[model samples]
Target chain A: MEQKSNKSLWWVVGLVVVVIAIYFAATGSPNPSSVAGKTVKIGFVAPLSGDAAVLGQEMQKIALYRVKQINEAAGENGTKFEVVYEDGKCAGNDAVNAFQKLTSIDGVKFIIGGLCSSETMSMAPLADQSQVLVLSPGSSNPKIEGIGKYTLSLSYSDKKTGEDLAKALSSYKKVAVITEQNEYNIGIRDTFLEDIKNYPSVSVVANETFPKGTSDFRSTLEKVRQASPDAVLLNPNPGVTAENLIRQLAEMKAWTGYKLFGQLAYLLDSGRAPAGNFTEGMIVIDAPNVNSPELLAIEEAINKDQGGTLNDLGHYYTASTLDAVDLITSLITKDGNDAEKVLNDLSRGRFKGHIGDIAFDGHNFVRITLSGKYLIQNGKAVLQSEQ
Target chain B: MVQILIYSFVMGTQVLLLALALFLVYSVSKVQNFALGAIGAGIAYALYFSISAHLQIVWTILLTIGVSVVLGIINFLLNERLTRKQEHLFALLTSFSFAIVLESLISIVFGTDGKNIIPGILPVYEFGVFQIPIPGLITICFGVMIAVLLFFFVHFTPWGRMLRAIAENSFSAESSGVDSKKVRFLVYIVGSFIAGAIGILAGLNTALTPTMGFQLIIMAFIAFLVGGVSDIRGTVIASYLVVLIPETIIGSLEGVSLNWKMVLVFAVASILLGLRPNGLFVRESRKS
Candidate 1:
């Protein structure tokens, strides 16, 4: 009788455990197939907060503006678009969460953005596995092309930017390279180095990589000053390192003699740039200016109809978001209810975008000819004379 | 090299504040307060808002300390109520939960945007090879002053003696008419206030963010663990060593990255911890 009672108690406990587990599993897990409507939902993931929040916020604002314009233009049949903005936060775990949430909870068929290259790289695998058409607006790292065929970028690749920079500095016989020892910085530096190799006259006199978030660049500056190259290539993005490097270079009087060549990271807002003549002669490679007359006209029309300025640099992100929306609309317009067909169309088609015409290679690499190298003159970034 | 040393001194002020907090809690209450980092982050956010709005720095620092003290008191009360009968592990879990709560609250309130504090004080000195920002130098001097004040308070005061007694034997201290609970509460409050001050100093030195505490917490933990948690002098020495040694070693490496340098620190710390569970300076007793 005792043994029978014990077995009954165990059975009850097991049933309770199973019921609780089932309840949690059902409630906690998201349903991914619930999205179906006239309005196509596109997910936007970017680092909306943290150290890179400024850039992320700009991207978010731009992306939202684009979606509003598209929805308004549909004028009842323009294929109404729904956008879900998720904060990637520029961290691996957060990127994964953003990807998972967009895919599962939102059931977004397409995703745009992921501002930082780091976040994009982290989200690439999840995007590839889920077969979601992932488009990055600001991620410029070349390694992103290797992630999968589903990943596409609106920005110029590191290699292309490097080659452009190399061409810009081709006249200089001796050059010094100082970059942060991170994947992104190293990628740009390596690409630039390789491109410069083609020009035998340009020999890298000094190659140095400093720690990111470093406050003092005196030692690094001293080394570069000693090398006394015709030009110095700085590949660190805008933050503590960039600020410190510029300050140290100015302090050491290296700015007077050597030309400064930097990556896109150096083209910071007016406030972050150094004071006086520190940035006058520096050149940087960045995305093509979308503020051109042709682009501005389109932006003005969009703003007139949609009530937001396309002149806003952040609107570039919105343009990228719209690209995703357009891709989805085109897909559905062609073959409704066929996700496979939509993915295949995206994989095969070439679309003219805000940056430029974008088409994916078989390796999932998006080729865009929007890369332009600019020089800083009087605190303004102007396209290089050659360009 | 002078610039590196100066930067290390500025960095050390922040580390010293964290070390002092950890030292107070461990030496007086026989507990580790993981919530120090969260408190620091919270205080930083508060100071950022105050400074941006053009409020007085004095008022801001006071408010930050007041809020931190309240949080510490609440933490103590919760630990007393929830885990008084439990072991050290349970106390640690309680502190960890409080830290998480503080972090999440900051995230919810601030929304995770990093705020850059415009330093009120400007750079006062610029040598040929180095420049010293007045605010950072002030922070270092302030740390030294606080350390001296804390030393005197702990060694020369009656409350300090009572705190020592409680730390040595809470039951004995309670039996001898010293209110152990009161001492514990006070220690927590003081410790949190120190953390708040450190947070403000860090904000002045660098940008403030919700997750900044995570990085500071690791450095603080290393400083405290290496210093011998219960020894103040040891912690101060360890703080400088922790910052300068890794920085120099990492600086010396030709191609090895900062990420790898961090890994090396963690590896070394792990080995040290394995050999000396009580820390390098403090000896662990076999009997509780």
Candidate 2:
């Protein structure tokens, strides 16, 4: 009886293998191009549904619109572009899985996104190994600099903004810093602290850090307020976390008598400003919202079909994302859709984009560090000046 | 220092309220209502909708409480049906599943982005060196009132005595003609209402996230365990100790990381429990 059972088990195992083999044979290997045509398929990873879904979905919309526009105005080469989207959920592990699925199953060479810094960084190692090009529209963590040869970001690093903010706010004698414990926010916090140290007058009165997903920060803010800092730096990623910091600061009654300073995340949207009057006159330092006539035309085109302006969700991100796509497509156009050749060309090329004249240094770091000073006036973000 | 104490009191009240709410259900049902936080999150979302719909604060509060009562009744019915055999672990699992479902439902309705019911800088009233926000003051007052009311209700009221009787021995309470099921259902409604109130207070203090109540509930559970899990007074006291010590002493330190707050909580709990394995508050007679 035992011998018969062993033989049956072996037969079952063999049958399962045969079934899987037959299924794969019948369904053929995964293909990048959804359709049979001369198409350059690009895998797009974005947080479709999660904490950062609003921003990610908006990025997806812009990417799709860009793809559609490219297809509509197919160049002389007749190279049609296709974007296959996978949800990264604005998380690390999810992005790794998405990256694996895109490269292994979808078989795409070029990819766009991993909008969040963590998502982008998680996939950097894999992308670097696979020699896949990852051009991010949103990741701004200082650590992402020289992460990989194929890894490049359209957004300016937080290191530059943090140092700029430190110098900008150095006039204040005392400053309190509240930061999120994420790679991106931590990068800003650390850089800001390092630069602020150079100014003897600017003593950091309180430096508080909250874990990611922590919305209740009243106590932390209370402690910060107790220090009576002349200025406060609230650094967190845009979306819920930033909004919470702003709102909680208001609730702690810590908004009065202190200069509120923020970074690029705060510049994403003014609707996120604490409603009524708390955020009035607050200053945020970010990349210049460089919009040209051509950029405005693209925005108009996008708004026509997207039912809203791309800047409604994210201003810099939209411009940078457009730049990312344009850069990739331009590089692909010049280099014949080869990922390695595109990287080589991008390393040596200076491209003009919607965000302005964009160029990468030898290490593929964006060189145009033009920071803009945005003031919250009338509950809206307006560019006050170029810093 | 006064500000740190104010912070502790305000934050501790939130934890205490949640602990008391959990204690109410646990004492009666011997089942940990893991959905306590989800129920609160649901109410917070309700408050968010009401505020978005331009409802007045008074109306929003009423609407939230009403929604919470409905949710409580649903929970009571579900728990009654699920644990008809009084299987504690099965009931806990059912509650956990219910929590996940409710949390998902909240996420679907509210989206994952956090929202503030009160979206502005709150005015602070200063009395000498002590500065207190209106919401924090309100939370403290409400917390005190609720604590006093709970103390009186559990000790003096006939229904409270019935609840205690059921907690001690449900079979004996039922033999004495006490409607244990009815009393348990009422406890659920009250506990859930308090949880909803805490949820709104928390929202008013900060912002509303689908998982906002998750940390609060975890802290409450820790308080329950540390406080002997069977003593009402001990749970109340433990909630404040667990929150205040870590938040004020550890969190307010200049260089100490906020990550250590949880570590400190567990360390303190371990120390106290190691000294008294049963619990900090368990009576010697009960152990025997």
Instruction: Give me the runs in candidate 1 sitting further than 4 Å from their true place.
Output: A1-37, A75-78, A167-183, A196-233, A237-259, A270-278, A297-318, A361-363, A385-387, B56-62, B119-124, B267-278, B283-288
lDDT measured at residue A270 in model 2 versus the true structure, 0 to 100: 37
Interface RMSD values, listed in order for every candidate: 4.9, 2.6
Fnat, 2 decimals, each candidate: 0.12, 0.57
Candidate 2 lDDT over residue span A219-312, tens digit each: 6777787788999988877777787678667655424788988876677663356645777788988776676777777777877877765654
Alpha-carbon lDDT of model 1: 0.69
DockQ of each: 0.10, 0.35
**Best by the lDDT measure:** 2
Worst 10 residues of 1 chain A by lDDT: A29-38
TM-score of 2: 0.87
TM-score of 1: 0.82
Local accuracy of candidate 2 as per-residue lDDT tens digits, B73-174: 988887886555788898888888888898888888888777777766666677776677777889999998998899899999987899899999988999
lDDT of 2 at B6: 79
- Local error of candidate 2 at residue B146 (angstroms): 2.0
User: Ten-residue segment with the worst summed lDDT in candidate 2 chain B?
Assistant: B279-288
